[model samples]
Target: MKQTTFLLVFGVVLSFCQAQSETGGEETGGEEEHVELFTTPATKMGAATSDFGYNLFRALASRESATNIFLAPITVSAVLTQLSMGGSEQAERQLYRALRYHTLQDPQLHTTLKDLLASVKAPGKGLSTAARIYLARRLRLKQDFFSLVEQQYGVRPKALLGGNRDMKEINDWVSQETGGKVQRFLAKALPRNSAVNTVSAAYFKGKWVTRFSQSGVMENFQVDGGSPVRISMMQQDNYPVKMGADSDLSCTIAQIQMQDDISMFIFLPDDVTSNMTLLEESLTAEFVQDLSMTLLPAQVSLTLPTLKLSYSTDLLPLLNDLGLAEWLETPDLEKISGQAATLSSVNHKVVMETAPEGNQYPSATSTTSHLSYRVDRPFLYLIRDEASGALLFIGRVVNPKDLSI
Candidate 1:
């Protein structure tokens, strides 16, 4: 069984909150001092990657309209950008165009990317990211390229010995990187013609700032208005959330606070059978940031499902659709080595588990208002790092019961 050329792993686990709890659901961010974020090379690069991620999501969602879709845009873009550093001029240009980095004004792209990675994966941020380059035992990288990659990306290239040993080695690295949450990353043997391969993995375990009043209860979730599935829906009363309505998209957008300066934004359509095409089309980095700053505070009765889902698929076709056919067909990776190399395969997998778990015990004085926000239908969501304004994960849930897609 031949395996893929590249593997992108995205695993997220929602654990307990151990931060200092707010005594009541007080209105936050209303009369606060709004400080403008200082611009940096990494932030510029992050904005570009966020745009690319939204485009990729649109392509995937258009293809699988009824299935759940989840991916780490930052991870995929980072891996591709790292690979581009090893490409020839033409190949690099092609890859940059695909990533929408042609117009980016970042001079120190790699250095800033290093900084962004460090910031997101910093201790207690609930995000861990790792990238590696695997070369066939018969091949070798240029000394300069090897040093650059090692110094910038913080990983040294390794040999891909064929068969079960190769499988174990790669999977073991993945398991170690994600603290054993992601195991057996490579399910089968490497392809007979495998050459230069890249693997990127990220593990995120977010802790909510406020704890729910109690455990989840059985509730009905409408799956595209076809049939209702009974899902364990978590509930929170008098939640201090940033929420607003978007008339253009016919959806209500809400932001739920999480620890470590992270926020989870949810977009729920007006009707069960409503089409989310408009909302998906309108997702951009700038637009999302505007929502974050502009949406008003509210105290609502919030109810959402306890999500445990995983999705895996090949992103090659999608990349081709995104205008990378020429590069994928005949990649010019002369910087890596003199020998000819081709990158025609890329695989992606994402696993996420989040529930209502925290140390902030619910108090009697948390209530503030009587607004309601119930997510009983299909919805879209994204996890963002507020400190860096980087999109960590984007996904849509059409049917929570159907775990895999």
Candidate 2:
């Protein structure tokens, strides 16, 4: 079997940064204001996060499959990073390959994650990321490993007392962190063979600066060139949204602000102009870094669909497919504990929604409506932190009506 070569980049889970109050658009008081709050200073780590995330998404979301895939790569990467902190050299090496920790050279991986998490958890972002490892009772961890987790990732180990009861404990932790969006994470009972379980959960609630209209109208959504279905199409006419057509990726890109520091990038591919195969192959972390600069301000007669997506499960199969065989097998986690540990599971859960705030027009007084990005068909989207370029979530929405099914 050939080993999978992952094109590494780190679009951290829903974490990104730095528009210091520029202009959200023209102010109401006759000032030549812009909707941009402040200009963000880019960071290498942030770009890495996006690169890692996009690559991972393409790996999982194949066109032959359902083509509707959604996952928070940052949450998974952060959890893996936490585990790597206590893993053996071999395990660490595999993790470094998968998560691409080497991408961030200066501040280092942990420091970069700490800074990114801080931004995501800040007031009003409506995003949360958490990682935890549960050890069976009487299984003591090394003091140094515990200290490292505390100092670097700010997570503490929760005791697993019973089988079913302990699963509830993990479930409750995820539920609280995700604002009740997630419940009952672990389905099966804990195995005696495994002594450690690593889990990560992320939740983000982004309100578009220019909101979608609550009263959506029925419109045709082209599933492919052959199939077109009517769906509730959300509209925002004459909206000032960043727009562009990426000839390289063959997708119409649009950026909608969730907050000054956070925004979402939508990539809509056409039937002939876009090929998912080529698009997937070309999504590098470096490419995403230039997104902000690549897209220009345009007056959009935006037509989007009300979106509600939730995906949850273990990514072990996908990892195995990604050629992370050693990762799934028993690894010498001597640093974490004397007891042997195998990665029994690497679990993830994510949910996202784009509800309307009733056609929220930006504060801009007047501007030429030049371009448009209408999401009338299947497309891809990235929720990112604009300042730091950290990717919070990456997904492909093929059929909105059948996304969850």
Candidate 3:
């Protein structure tokens, strides 16, 4: 049996918060202080797309909380930036509609979020309403763009591209969607010498709404091994920081309140450098439940530094390391491709980070990422319910290298 390839390189690029010596400072406009969120449609139709989107977001959130690096606004902002940069108007519209539909279809998700939001301090009563409208509009625009792309390119551009002439058209479309930021990247990253036919892209960016000031100087912040690294620190005097402890590890959950009732929870491992493999291995639906029970309130001064980083990794090895072998080892990807063809392999590369901008007290983090999959061999992939472990989207990437420009 051929080895299956599925890779996921996920991590915080860089994070920084700026603050003065005091609490309650005026908001600044910069990269370090802004946070944005966006979503996309992975498949054209059916329950797969819907379920994948929801599960992806939930898994991301859960992971952040577990790692003590919860930054919801930044995560959302990063996703939106990618969509805006890489997605077509129709693709964007489809994403928006899907998110809205999900919210409506599952009222409990909304209710739970609303309850969480209600507990936070609202800067202005109308701010939540404005936030909702902003989100709605963003989703709508994305959905419309997705539809346009489908109509113009057809569902499978590779199938449409029978010859070299068709490749040019597909490339042109890819160039237009990425605003030229990624044309060359895609060209170089994708497998050129293969029987593959079609390709798709996803990009993301995000910033904080209330950015941190960069003026404070701090030294010797503890990392995993008690080695203090001098980092640019953002100080918050009074905010919500909570703590919990289990026999295996101590956990901290911090809520960075955003507009309305939405807050980002940061979960920091008590032992930052402890073999993360155990934590990753132990991650499951029940793990999330256990983490949620750990949520409580505390008041402390937050000292986070501004840092920016980016990386790309293949997800196949990582997925295999995590015990998902059937997809990579078997030849059953026909169900996903909707065709009776032998699959290639699936590989994903992602880049993301938060960086500081100015020398002043107020600063922000700007993050961006690009994820691409080149299925040169056959393998299986699935999108599942984060809460229930239910499979939503499953398919095989057999000829990713042969995909048209």
Instruction: Name the best candidate (by TM-score).
Output: 1
Compose the digit string of candidate 2's lDDT tens values, residues 10-50: 12210111121122221231121111221222356566566
RMSD of each: 8.9, 8.7, 16.7
Q: Rank the candidates by lDDT, best first.
A: 1, 2, 3
Evaluate candidate 3 by giving its C-alpha RMSD to the native, one decimal. 16.7
Query: What is the Å distance of residue 117 in model 3 from its true position?
Result: 21
lDDT of 1 by residue, 1-405 (tens): 011111111111001111111211112331131123425566666677788888899989898887788887787787788789889899988988888788676777778777887787777667666567677756565767777778888777676788788779988987788787666667776787788776766666687887786556999999885879988888988666776676656678889988888889999888885357878888877677666765556556789888877565657678887788888877888888788777634655566667687556444563344567899999999998887778888998888888631
Maximum-lDDT candidate: 1
Tens digits of per-residue lDDT for model 3 on 43-140?
Answer: 11112233333334334423433232111121222222223222334433344343333322442332333322232213421111101001111111
lDDT of each: 0.73, 0.66, 0.29
Give residue 370's lDDT in candidate 3 (0 to 100).
Answer: 24
TM-score for each of the candidates: 0.86, 0.81, 0.42
How many backbone collisions does model 3 have? Answer: 79
Residue 170 deviation, candidate 3, in Å? 9.4
Q: What are the runs in model 1 whose C-alpha is more than 4 Å off? A: 1-38, 359-368
